[model samples]
Target: MTTPSTAGSLRSRAAESPVDCDVVVAGAGPAGLMLAGELRAGGASVIVLERLTEINPLLKAGTLNRPNIEAFYRRGLLPVLRQAQQETEWTVSYISSRRSDGTSTLPRFSGHFAAIMLSEELLDESDPDLAGLNPPDMVDLVHQKQVEAILADRAAGLGAEVRRGVEVTGFEQDAEGVTVTTGKGPIRCGWLVGCDGGRSTVRKLAGFDFPGTAPEITGYHGVADITGVQDLGVGWHATDTGVYLNDPPRGRITTVAFDGAPAGHDTPATAEDLQAAIRHVTGADATVTGITSLTRFTDNTRQATTYRQGRVLLAGDAAHVHPPFGGQGLNLSVGDAMNLGWKLAATVRGTAPDGLLDTYTAERHPLGAWVLNWTRAQIAVMRPEPHARALREVVADLARTVDGATYFAKKISGISQRYDLSGDNPLVGASAPDYELADGSRLADHMHDGRALLLDPTGARHDLVAPYRDRMRTITTAPLTDDAPAAMFIRPDGYVAWAGEPGRDSLDEALRTWLGAPVAYPSQTPDVVAAQR
Candidate 1:
């Protein structure tokens, strides 16, 4: 018989096992794979533990937003992703107006908020507030699985050890390191990161507090063959019961019903279950003949009260979750990985500045809260109540206007998000634009190696930056704009760290602040110097 004392002894023995690697990442989704690749590039050993034995082929998110697309390009993975999957042009159809002649005109939109269209024509690229940025071609569509496959390939090529069918059951952390207790065994590491989706075992085991609102409505998404189905056409539709959408090409059907009860994640949704949801939302007797994949979601918004508790940190959906509205979940999670990867890697390498790791939560928590509130507002506008319908109409009208559409477009595309970093420059906290150098090379062309970039147009800061060459890359280039600064400092994640005329003291301080102290040069001994002379 296994008594309490014996079990405790076994656990203690397991915890005393040898250290595994520098970092152990829980879950092998996009976030985990991306982090693993980044950590590998930054010279840290990583082990990714995933419970799933194989990749899930189900189509969850169908498109990548502009910011995520730019991230992929910055990493030189865009071409590889294109080679692996077919690219399709995508457009956001905001508000189509029917004229008196019964003809409708399609107004081009970058995206939408709460079903209200954000127009592309309304965006002024030259506006300083908008940072002279234009959304990428809307027609680019890539499958979620394709993205995961590409990331997995990249991570494996970089020598990250990925173990499948391994579940992290518990963990214990102290000042020295963390011991992750998994089904296989206890693996010690300098750090443990939870990238494990919404119901993260790592988060729960670490005793992180997740507090948020309960789900207001139950949502369903399924791909199936239908029989005796009425053609509701393709696009979002709001009915008296709730909402429903049908896409014939993809053989996809989706519905949202305000039933006030959440679905069980353990329960496998059947064809009949999807049929019932369809009937309830559309009030149509559509019979489902087969179900390829059926899943349930909710607006159960939640976020970790803190991202890091000791050495255990959280990222991606493990840190925050919300309704997958406007396809922001994947984009937000990818952004989280990008932001956390370099910082965590530096922390493991002991090269990070003071409070650098703390900035992960400081910067990302507000962004996560914004996304959660964004989805919540969408849900409120999409409710079946009369007030919601009236408000939706008002929002639709506002979305058709130029200013309103531009604002929404910026928000939805993530171009408008600016971190509250300490800088007066307009581009400091914004996404770095693809600056065109004098040689016709773009900024992304030089960022493939994942190192900080220092662009000096006038070549004045060459001596000042020589000390930090090992930690940063310096380039001499013509000014990107007529009023552009003489020099600019860009972090590894492609955010402007500092921008101004080249000043020795300021540049040195900025380098120390972002890239850690410069490597010390060993002085020559007196005898060696005399011999050389």
Candidate 2:
């Protein structure tokens, strides 16, 4: 938690605000709402502009990966997420499949690359590549709408104003701030963030360069009343025509055809259109009698050249977009919000280190490119041609092996994602372990307030971090095991800034690099002061 003096200083800075808000978010999707809540929590004022009055009830992304689940847990919202899962029965089997003892009640399927499912039984958990990775309990199925609702409520509760039926038609940024032109009126903010979806007006208005590969497949995701398709079994079917996945119990069917991009994305999909896609992809005599919800997408991959242009920034799909494969879109968006929220807020409060905001692009852009290539690799393997099909067969054979399964699980489960922080300690750029403290509480229990943390498990590093009390919290815990770091400096977004390794950068160097220079606390003596220097 931030100290009172620091909180007071931030509040005074907000009270002296010239703009209507510190940040203006251009979308109310999961990414936008999550950013709003994070900004408010970090002491930045925010206003979220959403074009729609109600949440979109589409079955877009239906799963939360490890990082996203850990995000919710750190915010103390896991109970709410669990409640949402229970209420909606959306992938409730995933929740029930795992017992309290952490063993699966059913066959564990981590995820898939392309259409090849990765069975956990074939994975070697003891592999060094799997160290400090996500446990099965951290992954679950949660609806995107539920996540939006949850983040919206949280943002509102934290004093963020959300305006519906508002569209951002234009935006202009000068030396100081951005003036957003909207349907309601012009909103002035110190910073502008585009969290809108793929066709982002903010991106266009702000003049950010977006470039990537063209689409080779048109995908359709929908749920509808069906008939004449009794043999359309569940799971992925990589037929000669294309790939199709069916979930009969949920009345959901997804089909991807190796066609060019849709004629026009503006046109809504119809039942006949879905029926045609089903027939084309699966060669099944399937008929769509009536549609419940339907949407069309293409494997059009693109990413922004940079995340920030002066006072304007982009996140989520606005920053990067690709085919919605492996349920990575939501996770990627949420991660952007998490990584940028604290840094933007610190900058707004006039406490950010030099070039801290620039790191957002430096770190996230490569990961976005990786996800694009990941989806592209899947598309190449599932291309509906003989060569691609034969290659997919060979890939499938590899996926059935223990080592191959682990590799796929690492990428698909979001465990292999790490920022390059240039440190010898392997944990430096990885997510901090949820270590249990001496008081019997997990490390996440102390992070709900969105402040950095210094975990001194051996109780020997307190003197080194005493001056940065206003910027972070320090907890002394029981001694960590030999494999874990003796002490770790964790950032607000749960990444390890530095671990106390002999050959790595010192703790003071990391603290200043990430959180700016330390303050002079009265408890600090000349010896401690010299140590920090």
Pick the TM-score winner.
Answer: 2
Give candidate 1's TM-score: 0.88
lDDT for 185 in candidate 1 is 89
lDDT of each: 0.76, 0.83
The deviation in Å at residue 178 for candidate 2 is 1.0
lDDT of 2 by residue, 339-458 (tens): 999999988876777788899999998988999999999999998888888999999999999889988888887877789996678888988887655555777877887888877655
Q: Give model 2's TM-score versus the native structure.
A: 0.92
TM-score against native, each model: 0.88, 0.92
For candidate 2, the per-residue lDDT at 428 reads: 87
Query: What lDDT does model 2 reach?
Result: 0.83
RMSD of each: 8.1, 4.5
Error of 2 at 317 (Å): 0.2
Model 2: per-residue Cα lDDT at residue 288:
89
Whole-model lDDT for model 1 versus the true structure?
Answer: 0.76
Query: Which regions of candidate 2 are displaced past 4 Å?
Result: 1-17, 129-139, 458-463, 501-505, 521-533
